[model samples]
Target: MTTVPPEAERLLENEPVMAHFATCADGRPHAAPVWFRYEDDTVEIVTTGRKLENVRENPKVALSIQADDGGDTQWMVTLLGTATIVEDEAETDEARRRINEKYGAPSDAYEENELVRIDVGTASYRTY
Candidate 1:
């Protein structure tokens, strides 16, 4: 597993931060905000619909998270990686728990959701 940088690690673990999950299909880009869990040097998100379909066709993906307090200070992190649909029932269940907890979702919610894991290949951040 690749080691997550300290700054990126903090951002990933923060529960309230929303990540923009991006995928490409047929040269078109698609992105959406998501509640995510970062662990074992991987980013996991439970989602379905077009995002899932895009990753199925193209494993390459990106995740961007930013913070803005409406002040001069701002920071952002972007992670580039390859995403795989998680098929193992056990892993999917765990992912569901983590994602739901992060977003304060009811325990029963997201149980039937699909899981996607992104193995981060590169990460970059900017602060100002």
Candidate 2:
């Protein structure tokens, strides 16, 4: 069993912001901002909007969690993973709870929308 490095674990456990998710389409990348929570070896995010379309068309996804600054020096973690849809209510609810805990509870606006999730398959990190 591989253990998460101390630096990696610390960065994730105390991350200040959510990263953008990019999915490949026709050799190009579609990017969007998303909030995420880490569980075990995976990073999960909520998006019942745009992500639903991107992930459906291409399951291959790359997600990044990093400091929200335009400067060249920033801490970033990039993940290469297969984004599988979580259609199960329980699973979705669990994801909701985790997300709410991290970013605050979901708005009533989310209730009106359909939300699907993406699970990070493999993660890599870089701090500059």
Candidate 3:
């Protein structure tokens, strides 16, 4: 697994930016915005539909997040990883808690849903 830089890690943990997630479909790119949590050097997401189907067929994926100050400052982080469809209920529950807490959602209202774990293999960032 590739190590995320300290600054990038801090940003990921604290920033609420939406991640642009991408998966391969028939050797082409399919991308969408997603709410995600960064933990244990992995990116976690709850999703269904085409994104889930794409991952099941091809585990490789990419995600990117960016932040801007509305002035002259901006930063972006990109990650490459292998995505796994989590089937274990226990892990899914834990993912629910973490994701909800990160977004200030009702933790007790956690619902069982499709979970995806992206084990990050590479990370890159740029700030301007």
Tens-digit lDDT track for model 3 on 97-123? 888788888864447457899999999
Q: Clashing pairs in model 2?
A: 48-115
Q: How many clashing residue pairs, candidate 2?
A: 1
**Candidate-wise lDDT, in order:** 0.85, 0.68, 0.87
Please tell me which model should have the higher lDDT, number 1 or number 3: 3
Residue ranges of candidate 1 with Cα displaced over 4 Å? 1-3, 71-73
> Residue-wise lDDT of candidate 2 within 8-62, one digit each (tens)?
7677766648778888666689888877776555667767666677788888888
Which 10 successive residues of model 2 have the least lDDT summed? 107-116
Off by over 4 Å in 2: 1-6, 68-72, 106-109, 112-121
Task: Name the 10 consecutive residues with the lowest summed lDDT in model 1.
Answer: 1-10
Which candidate leads the pack in lDDT?
A: 3
Query: What stretches of model 3 exceed 4 Å from their correct place?
Result: 71-73, 108-112
In terms of TM-score, how similar is model 3 to the real structure? Answer: 0.89
TM-score (all chains, Cα) for each model? 0.89, 0.77, 0.89
- The lowest-lDDT stretch of 10 consecutive residues in candidate 3 is 105-114
